[model samples]
Target: MDQTNDTAETLTPQTVRHSILWRVIFYFATASIALSIVVSAALVVWNYEQQTEAFRERLEDIRVGYSESLGSSLWFYDEIQIQSQVKGIMNLEAISYVRVTDNLNINIEVGTRPHHSDIETLPIEFNGKPIGVLEIAFDRDAVIAKASRAAISTMIAQLVSLLLLASMLGVVVHTLINRRISEMAAQVNDRLSSNQYSPLAISTGKDKDEIDLLIQAFNALSEQMIDQLEQKTQAQQQLKTINLELEDRVKERTHNLQKTVDELNQTLAELHATQGKLIEAEKLSSLGGMVAGIAHEINTPLGLCITIHSYINDNYQVMKRAFDGGGMRKQDFVDFMGMMDESLGILDKNLQRAAHLIKSFKQVSEDQTGEHIRRFSLHDYLHEIMETLSPKFKQTQHKVEIDCSENLWMETFAGSISQVVTNLVMNSLVHAFEHTKEGLIRIQAAEEKGNIVIRYTDNGCGLSAEAKHKIFEPFYTTKRGQGGTGLGMHLVYNIVHQRLKGEIQVEEADQGAAFRMVIPKITEESNVQ
Candidate 1:
């Protein structure tokens, strides 16, 4: 008896409800309840809108019919008639209260207005003049009660119908599927536990429904399982062979990967060495061009000096001959002295010009070769560099303008600065003015917030998007074969980024290429290195 009681307690309502048939019925009932609630809410809203519309129509009727009578009563000062007319309006549909107010300060209110009533007011006019106002308050609770009763009836009917349908559906599902499923479950459990593979058997008619198909599938699966059991030993051997082959392949691949990594490392070291050599070659190439330009510039002045020397020598021979022959006079000596003065002055001027050109060339060459820090005016250095580079521009119609403040001075490594400017100027001359005549290159410098901002621009053919992107890359040049080494701008980039520790960027321009560089007034040696 105690065991029976414990068994009954275990099959409690909660456990019993977990059955599939019960769950299907419960879900249907919940859906029916939710749908009923939604329908009821919609029905209530529709009824309220209709009721409110009817209430508005009746209010309009009261306004048109009662305004004139109420106005006549107030104009005649008839208190009894005003009360009678207001009571008449209150008797209309849904109107709970009426109030009449006249110009004479007579206010008459009648009927009881609930807290939730809607009120409307109308002006009372007689003979085209306003006499008083009529207010009507309508009761909404009675209408709401009617709509609620109708909605409740509808919800009850739907809930009953849905529950009946849900019960029938649950019974059908249990009879058609649940009983056969239970039998199949028992057969599968028996086969799994006892290691006896066998087809499940359940009685079925000739209809070939879902249960018949499920039985066929189960029988086929049982035959496949038996075949798998027979091949289990062979499958284990095959798996071992596959794993060994995979291990060998992995070892071979790992060895090859290591070899490839070593090769890559060696290649990278070689590339760095080659790049350093190329950079040195590029610097030397720029220095060689500067030397050639200076030589060409110095030749003209030296040639003039030679010519002047010969002319003075010839004149000295003439004067010495006249003195030695005893034919020299005071006027003749004065004439010879004046001629010597003029010739010597011309010789001295040419010599001084040649000396100045050589001095500027030497200074630029020294800065280009090594790093040297010296306080110098930016304006003077630009003119000096331009003087040395004048040979390249002097032959062309192109002009170079420098716009640096004379007071701006820097005490940093001038070599890098000189290299960067020289490269940029050369780059513009070579690439920027390819097809244009009278091109203008402008270099502007200013000191802002302890940094030197330099803007280099040219009024010539601008750089294409591709060229601008790879301009600083080594061995990248538009004029590949026309004496372009393709390392000028690359060297410039290295000098700015690695030597000066500055930033350079390409900017937009109207008719040409524009580049902006911002260099710090003082740079740390560690940062530069």
Candidate 2:
């Protein structure tokens, strides 16, 4: 018997002891009862008030009628008619008493007199003259009793109807929702207890209720879990197979990776050498351009000088022939002397100008190529550099101005300084004023606290924010593919910072680009390289 009991307990589906349908019914019944009580009490109070008001009005009407009847009877001295009206008023169910009185000493009364609290009085008149007063009392208890009965009957009806509604609702809820939910809960418990992953058998037909939907979702989730488990098992097998081949693949991959690394190292070395060659080529190209410009400038003056010298030589020959033939008159001699003086003056001035230009160019070119460290006047050196670059701007409206203290001198890398200044000026010509015809470049230098500060500014299109950020970065150029190797500014940056031991920075300008360079007048002992 004990074994049978245990088996039964095991097979029985676990369910909640309390029924949801009963709980819902109980709550609904409680609310209905509460509402009924409230409505019943309200109705009782309201009926009581209404009945009391009606009774008061009826009592008032009785008093008015009695006053009129008694007024006429007193005027005619008809005692019997007055008595009849008083008796009729007293006969009403809510009327407790009635009285008639007047100033002429006439008086009448009927029934037992009610207390003053229940009595009300009305004045009577006859032909615009005072005749009598009529008073009546109402039975308050009787009126309240009628209202209470009506309220009680309404309450009973509401309670009965509510009970029936609650019963019907409980039956429907249990049949349609509660029983199905209980069955679903039992099935879910059974699956959980037995660790079963089988899909639940639930109807998902045209009338798809919430319970049916929940069951369908649970079943789908079970199927998905089963599929995932199968996939996991298959993946484990595949992982084992992959592990078996991993060693061979690793060996092959390592060999390929080493080969790739070697190739990358070789490519990197080649790239470094190529970059060096490119930089050198850029420098040569710049020097070639300078040489071309200088030649062109020199040719102009040289050609003019040649023509003037030839003209003077031909005049001298003509004068020599005239003198030899004794045909030189005083006026002709004076004219010839004046022409000779003018020619000599022109020749001397042209030769001096050409010589000065060549000297400046030679000095600047030598300084740039020699990399000599020498004590030089900053102002004079800057002038020479500008002279060398003048040919580039001779055809344009751009002007270059240099301002430096005359006594300020520095023993430093003259070549690097030349390179730095040349790159900056060239950058302005190529990039800063690419669109503008007329521009002004100003270079101001001064010695400050044993350091030289050079401020360079140009009244041209200024560098854009992006350009300013990357202007000194190697191989970054806005004029790519147009003879811009992008090394000019980079070289400037390197020469100034690395070679000259100076720092250069871009600064805000009113109308164009500005740069500030601070270089030590005397190099540090350890940083001489």
**Which candidate number would show the highest lDDT if scored against the true structure?**
1
| lDDT, residue 356, candidate 1 | 91
Local accuracy by lDDT, each model: 0.84, 0.82
Segments in model 1 whose C-alpha atoms lie over 4 Å from true places: 1-240, 320-327
Tens-digit lDDT track for model 2 on 329-430? 888878878988987788788778778888987877787777557788989988888877888998899999888889989888776777788888998999
As a TM-score, model 2 comes out at: 0.56
lDDT value for model 1: 0.84
| TM-score of decoy 1 | 0.59
Query: What would the TM-scores of all predictions be?
Result: 0.59, 0.56
